[model samples]
Target: MAARLPLDLDPPVRQLRALLLGVDDRELIAPTPCPGWSVATLLDHLMSLAEAFTEAARRGADAGGDRPPRPPSAAHLSPHWRSRLPVRLEELATAWHAPVAWRGLARAGGITMPAPEMGVVAANELVMHGWDLARATGQDFAVDPRVLAALVPFLSAAPAEGTPGFLGPRVPIDPEEDEWPRALGLAGRDPAWRPPRSHDVPTVRRGSREQPPAARRA
Candidate 1:
């Protein structure tokens, strides 16, 4: 079905872009939820994945079918990362918009699979890692309910824990919970994860009252 060829990716992609843009040089060195990956390394990984998946969507001569996927490293990040990454994210969404992009087998990260499945994987990467970046940076984030609903079945069937370089053990949650929390649990993320409370979120004070600052999001 034509529906299988593409899922509108622009929303999650844009959300990811917002998170990336908000990152600063100081924050780049901060660690992410991904084990051993700092913000810079994670951004580098996103850049690599975006390029790989774009070629995968192309499935054409220009696609680097013969080339093995590059290992993501902070050293590989471009000096122009601030400008380059957002554009690459846009390209990733655009590349998948074509119906032909999903017509056959596609390869990314040295793995080949049906293009539709790859497309869904792309969505998962954007959302899950977007959450990772937000949490690591102490930013507010929310997924569209429909988006989480779409991912429920896939993550639901996935293991509670994963190996290094994959999802870690699934955090416990009420099985009958909101899709967002449930999805996080299924993705091996603790729904309760928080930035170190060493005053990571500052407090605000009015003339007579003080209020704890909250994470900001769009």
Candidate 2:
């Protein structure tokens, strides 16, 4: 039988790289559905988070602990995200995915679910934002089923109430299917998104709460 791909970001990075392969490097610098982030900025943030998570996962694996810290704030990350973004992302992904005994150790601490939490987070960024990037730049993209499956629980997870923008609409769950996309739909990010032929990205309509400005990549 073929080797089973990890249903997480380690393998899914291949999918993200493939989505980006044909697109112009310049489009990486354009504006996305995200408000303050230009495409370049967004890509940098995604890549940065992937790298950061990988490090955190490594730490978690090594010590059998919870996740590492969030990536440094956007203000601190902006210069590098714009300049050395791709290189950093590549390095981090590679380092984190390296073979190590810590892989199994990460689950021992109970900080994340078994089988690497960073992979889950990475998978979401790659799958969803790959679609966002494709839509923003007019490239075609498709989400992997494994990636989507991982997001089901991530979106259903709730932050404390009054957590500002994190508290999105309370979309009901089917309990039988994944919750992320449905949550995205409730957030106006599902099938409604369409890419521009040239430079204009589509705007999201707010249904209940005034559509807050698009979130900046962190």
For model 2, the run of ten residues with the poorest summed lDDT: 160-169
> For each candidate, what is the lDDT?
0.78, 0.52
Tell me the tens digit of each residue's lDDT in model 2 across 1-218: 54344553544565456555545666655666654556665565566566555655565544434544343333444544433544555654665555451255443222455445555655565666666666666555556565666676665564423123222344444556545457454333544455454455434421223232565332
Q: Could you give candidate 1's per-residue lDDT for residues 8-33 as a string of tens digits?
A: 78888988888876787987878887
Question: What lDDT is obtained when candidate 2 is compared to the true structure?
Answer: 0.52
Best by lDDT, which number?
Answer: 1
Model 2, stretches more than 4 Å misplaced?
1-6, 25-29, 61-115, 159-183, 186-188, 195-218
Cα deviation of 167, candidate 1, in Å: 2.5
Listed per candidate, the RMSD to the true structure in angstroms reads 5.0, 9.5
* Candidate 1 ranges with C-alpha deviation above 4 Å: 1-6, 60-68, 197-210, 213-218
Show the colliding residue pairs in model 1: 160-170, 161-169
Q: What is the TM-score of each predicted model, taking all chains together?
A: 0.84, 0.56
